[model samples]
Target: MEYNTERTTLKIPEYGRNVQRMVDYCLTIEDAEHRNKVAQSIIDVIGNLNPAIRDAPDYSHKLWDHLFIMSDFKLDVDSPYPIPTAESFVGLPDEVPYPQKSRKFRHYGGVVKTMVKHAIEMEDGEEKEALIYGIAYAMKRNYLKFNKDTVSDSTILTDLDEMSEGKFKTEGIDLPHSKSFNIAPAERNTTAVRKKGNNNNSKKKKRRY
Candidate 1:
């Protein structure tokens, strides 16, 4: 038996050893026409093996890229799309940028801070005043949600002012009562539990005989 440890390593292991071997064989064919036919066949096999990519927008193009990748960019068959170089895909996916802005009041969450910022930028008017109050209410709600203990409306307003660099003047804004944001626990099925208990009792009595 030819152990995997003894054989050459596969470039893309998802296609398995047989597929890798087929790709290696295609590299040896001298006739350009025959080699292209065999390359297309290999791509077809790969596409069928991974049915998930069949519905993708550039499915065929992706398959051709994978074929060249598996062959280590040595496959010279005419490609339907632009030939991809090893360097183009060297780094793989780009890194996603993380939010660097630090929040002192993390308990109120980031959304509250974002709202406060937007409220600060708006032109001062009745509309801006409503938004300022809305942000304070949200801050208070978020504070109550995060911390089990109740937070005063003043504290929420103070936090809003601090986050917005005193831009949002919520000195007299009153937030809704803490009870408004209280998350109620899910109720148990008491009736079903009682029925289940009675059924168990009846089953026990019958089983005793």
Candidate 2:
């Protein structure tokens, strides 16, 4: 008697190294609840690390490809499609005007501005006034330049002190005045000192003769 034989083959989907690692890690978790929580946490971490990934253009394409391979040509699920929204037909709205391009910079600036405003309103004194003046001074001088070498904070502070003097002036705020603020006289004296030293050297040569 002859027996009929039949054989079947299985095809496995190939995943990228990173995706394979993630899949292996997920499979290692025994409990379904814990596995889901871990997976969500991982997704959240990735989103935080690369915010651009959240609104990526090619994400749907990549997802559909992965789904197709995973289904092994058996599942009849439709390919992923872009969700229709009121804004989808229209282009993205213009970004709000802000000094710095970085979100972190804007966040920190907002916090500083709020705290300084509160301090100015609640307190009444030279120190408070100076603090407010300083804040305004900083805001006026604050700028972001790409591709430039990093400058020392001290040098930036000095530049701010010079440039923001009249620009940040506010009504009813009196900054402490210093008596020794003569730039021209100081420069003239420095020049005179050098001249006198040179004359002294000339007199020594005459005496040697």
Instruction: Compute the lDDT for candidate 1.
Output: 0.64
Q: TM-score of model 1 relative to the true fold? A: 0.42
| Residue-by-residue lDDT tens digits, candidate 1, 5-90 | 45577666666544575688789888898788668767755665555656778778878877887788888888889888898687
Number of the top candidate by lDDT? 1
User: In candidate 2, which residue pairs clash?
Assistant: none
Give the distance in Å from residue 177's predicted Cα in candidate 2 to where it truly belongs.
Answer: 68
CA shift at 194, candidate 2, in angstroms? Answer: 60
Off by over 4 Å in 1: 91-209
Pairs in clash, predicted candidate 1: none
Q: Model 2, 97-198: lDDT tens per residue? A: 222223333312432333243443433554345445544433332321111123344443443344334333355433222222122433434545665786
Q: For each candidate, give its TM-score against the true structure.
A: 0.42, 0.20
Q: Where does the lowest 10-residue lDDT sum fall in candidate 1?
A: 92-101
What's the lDDT for all of these models? 0.64, 0.37
